[model samples]
Target chain A: MDAMQIANSIPMWVACGIPVCLIIFQSLLFMSKARQASKDIGLSDDTVKKAIRASAITSIGPSLVILSGMLSLLVTVGGPVGWMRLSLIGSVMFEGIAAGIGTQQVGVTLGADPMTPTALAMAVWTMVLCSIGWVIFATFSASRMEKIQHKITGGSTKRMGIISGAAIVACFSSFVASHLIKANADVGFYFSKNAVAAILGALFMFIMMKISAKHKKLSEWNLTIAMVAAMILTAILPIGA
Target chain B: MNKEQKTEYFENTYMPKMHRYGKLIGVIGVLVSFIPPIVLAVVFKAIPDWGKLPAAFLTGAAAFGFLWIMEPIGYFNILGPVGTYMAFLSGNISNMRVPCSSMAQVSAGVEPGTEEGSLIATIGMAVSVLINVTILTIGVILGTVVLSKLPAGVVGALNYLLPALFGALLMQFGIKDIKYAIGMLLYCCVLYVLIYLGVFSWLPSAANWLPIITAVFGGIAFKLIVDSKKDKAAAAAEKKDE
Candidate 1:
């Protein structure tokens, strides 16, 4: 059979489905524990429900974005693998890059050359191997991080909060900064629609937060509104161009 | 809850159970991740050249190895332990999981880095994983027909989804402390520029991680310095009163 046929075969679907199933199982398990803990901590059931609602709402746009990217993966790697990988432990960006690198190892570029079964094997191997590092690191080190945070903050909850807040701000700032600046061989550095999207997103979110403070009901939709507004403006305007 | 109850919940119930189950699931996840490739080899008779496997793995490692270690450590504070397990296993950490976690915390009015925050983050991440997987499944089954009909403009805008999410999240966190927000944003932008200009040539793949490391630790250091200075001033005022 050809690579595509093998990639979408029944066995392949069953094989890939295992991890996806595992992911769901793990999420459900952890979520149940968290629910119990939430009750123990005296958080009202309404708060938990609100969090679920907000998170579910916040997830749709990005998941749709991943769906679009999955189309490219579907063409390159076939449906089952693409569906499984993206549904489980891989992002659109990482999976594509890893697959390309894998195919290249066999002297074949992913989109440019005909895919052989050998290339498919290499691609799957590379994707899996590359991601293993995260699981391994987390398995060993996750439990230790709280101790590290404690040491850093000298066991003060307030100080820990400051450090955590600083870290999150730093992390997101780095992400935004990367999006805002683009380098071209000819242009040196220039902002693109991506930059506009980011800036507008921040601005819209700021406004939403201000308004939500008074309205309260608006808080649940703040992220969704900000993101949609920014995306629409960035798409329609030529500002950063 | 009272202090004693909170401590009991975290110490006796939450942390231990999460650690044990999380590690088990993680190990199983690693083992199961290899099944697809193994099946391809065994069932389809499509085995790669064993000799070239290392080179291919190295290529991916070279690109992503730093993220494997750094992402877990860097995202831990915000995600906490339970959220970390769910986030890594579910992927799309930055774009999907983190944003959902943050939104949940905000909507629930829970402070980040606290036990309540951790539970809320977990609920958020779990919901996102379920929702994300459901959407992905539907998209995979029906997307080819529907997506082909989407306008080019709409498709093009999809590219901005992540940047916009990051931007919104930055605002969400930034409002908590405007000074740190501004300072860290400037710090990251400057570091990103330096990396882009190849100023950090001696560092391997500095672009992937340098900005993140510096920004996270640098922000902490800056906050510490400012806090100590404030403490000093307060101490002087108290001494004068005495």
Candidate 2:
């Protein structure tokens, strides 16, 4: 093979480079904010760092395993349609995990990534893995702080109450409506991206609210709206993506 | 403790450590990006490649972009363990093509009936996925079971629920103008219609990603332009009122 051909042939590095970059970048950004948030909230740094480190370690094992799978597919079952399908699963799972069990509780969405099940499954394992560390940190570091222990909780119970009520209403409403019925899980990729974007924006607003002391109900309003919208998206969208 | 002591204790203790942890997380994140594909390539028996990077700048650039975008929206819960797990799984399935998060758009060699290791890995990944879904479904079902007990006409209530949640979330700081929301919605509908009609079939490769071509991109772009105009109008109105 020519130099170029030989070089291009090693598809794994070339292909995954962007996503990995995005992931790492995402992780670092998360870490930084977590730092700011901890400081802002008056939590101990070592605890937060420990949580992040534990999370990172827990996260990587699966990522590499998945990476191995992707390489196998590249050498086996390749195409854009398949790749798109994979992205569907990848994006949701990624977002779902980031959001926590609150997301996990939301059933399959119509617009969910075509691979939602896979993503969801990964999310379960992630939760399982991270919970171990979360418990450890909670037991030792955050023993005194009742509020902070639930940091990774994702408020699953509350979010479910909100999303399910919304979805049931939506579903029944669709049944009654003449034209605008509830479509099957039609979560487009853009929706996920937008959701991520909104969630992030709202997070900033929430942080700002906590730090400022002058709690603007408007920001709380923003948080509520964002969470609900995210839930609706979570509800009506998909089982796969 | 006195108020002064509280402030001093907080500033002296909490903030600095969080900052340091944040940096540590950032540095670790930068380092972690380079792993998955490398490991995967080796496992798949393919010759691992020299990727597009090895350049320090690449890592730095990646670090910057990720930090900026993620910092704004995250409470770190945004990086939920579940999402990462799902990502890893997607990576496994896409292994049939490319790894999850891989930049590769196409993996030319793959088709049905390839290598045993690859296929087995794919199947194994699939089974693992089924297990994951079961857990999530249980979560969903349990949630729905709770919702089932709520008051009647759930549909109508939630009709406003989405918008209500949106309003609550932004504290009414939505894409505030009804016109913009409608415009964005219409653009989405129309694009969906045309794309559904197969107009995209006629477009060239370049045109494939055309604003009119990709439903989401084109629609969002149109919406952004309209929203900006709306923003300007609102600003002008405020100025005039003042």
Candidate 3:
């Protein structure tokens, strides 16, 4: 069968469900363990509940944004593959590029024609194989990281926390700095919408934080608020072209 | 039991169960992850072109291979083992999981790496997975027609959203530790400027990695420097007391 036919096939959908179920099952087990651990550690139930609520609330906006990306993937790879990949190991950005590169290698443009089963196979292979690095590293080395970190910090969780926070800062600074590099090269008022958007996002984040202090519920929505405001700013601003 | 012994027991007894279950399910996930491709190839006799496979794999890997290695090492401290496993498996680590986990930690008033913080982060990540799956599933069921109808300008702006989000996230982190934040920002600026000035242009690949190296290692170095100063001060105080 062709890509479209296979994608819509009941068997493919069922196959997709396997990974989804595994993820859900694993998540549920972990959550329960964490919840029990929380209680054993004398954590107030209210704090745990607030975490669950805030996390869920914060995820909605980003998830919608991801939904748009998933829709685009569906246009190229069809429903089952797109759904499963997005639902499991891949994200909005990763799978599309992987599929595009896979199709390009075989001299077929994704979404340009009906993908033969072979073409579909290529996409699947690329997506699955490309993503294995994350799984492989995590599987073998994940547990070891705690030990390594403990050794590095000389058993100080506080120092480990600082190192972790610093890592995040550094990682994000690099990403933010890349935009500045792009903007620097452009030599225009706002040639890089990314830079503008990033600055605006920071602005919005500050505003949200300021407001959330008084309002409280807004804190839960800080990410969503900043992101949406920045999205609008990027749309209206004369940049990113 | 003392707090240390309790923590040890939790790590020894409870953590092993997490590892067993996580590894078991993770192995199954790895195995099942390949089913779609294998079945597609076997059932349809549509194995990919052997000649094209290497190029295709390399092309895909080239873009993401670094992230696969770096992300786990980078995020492990905050996300911990369970969060690490789930985040990598479910994907969208930087954009979705980190924010949710961090926010959860903040809202719950816990520092990451402690037992309470780790638990909260895990719960937050799991909830995010559920929410992410739910929303994406609905979008899938709704089909592309309605989704594609979203205004061009609005969709165009989505590209900037993640970049912007990252910038905001830096601020969130910066507030907690201004010294490290400033140090990291400076380190990134220096590296990026160096790359732009063509210092690393001789080795183009070096430019690609310099920012992250600056971020991870540079930040660590700054932390060490700051910590040493604090240690010195404490030691001097103790000496004075003596």
User: Which candidate ranks first by DockQ, i.e. highest?
Assistant: 1
lDDT top scorer: 1
Question: How would you encode candidate 1's per-residue C-alpha lDDT over B112-132 as one tens digit per residue?
Answer: 777888889899999999999
Better of 2 and 3 by lDDT: 3
**Whole-model lDDT values for every prediction:** 0.87, 0.31, 0.79
Which of 1 and 2 is ahead in TM-score?
1
- Worst lDDT run of 10 residues, candidate 3 chain B, spans B201-210
Candidate 3 lDDT score at position B75: 68
- Candidate with better DockQ, 2 vs 3: 3
Top of the candidates by TM-score: 1
Candidate 2, lDDT over the whole model = 0.31
Model 1, position A18: C-alpha lDDT score: 95
Candidate 3, residues B19-99, lDDT tens digits: the string is: 777767767888899888877776667688878988999987777877777767766766778888888888877778888
* Model 3 CA lDDT for position B76: 72
Best of the two (1, 3) by DockQ: 1
What DockQ does candidate 3 have relative to the true complex?
0.66
| iRMSD values, candidates in order | 1.2, 20.0, 1.9
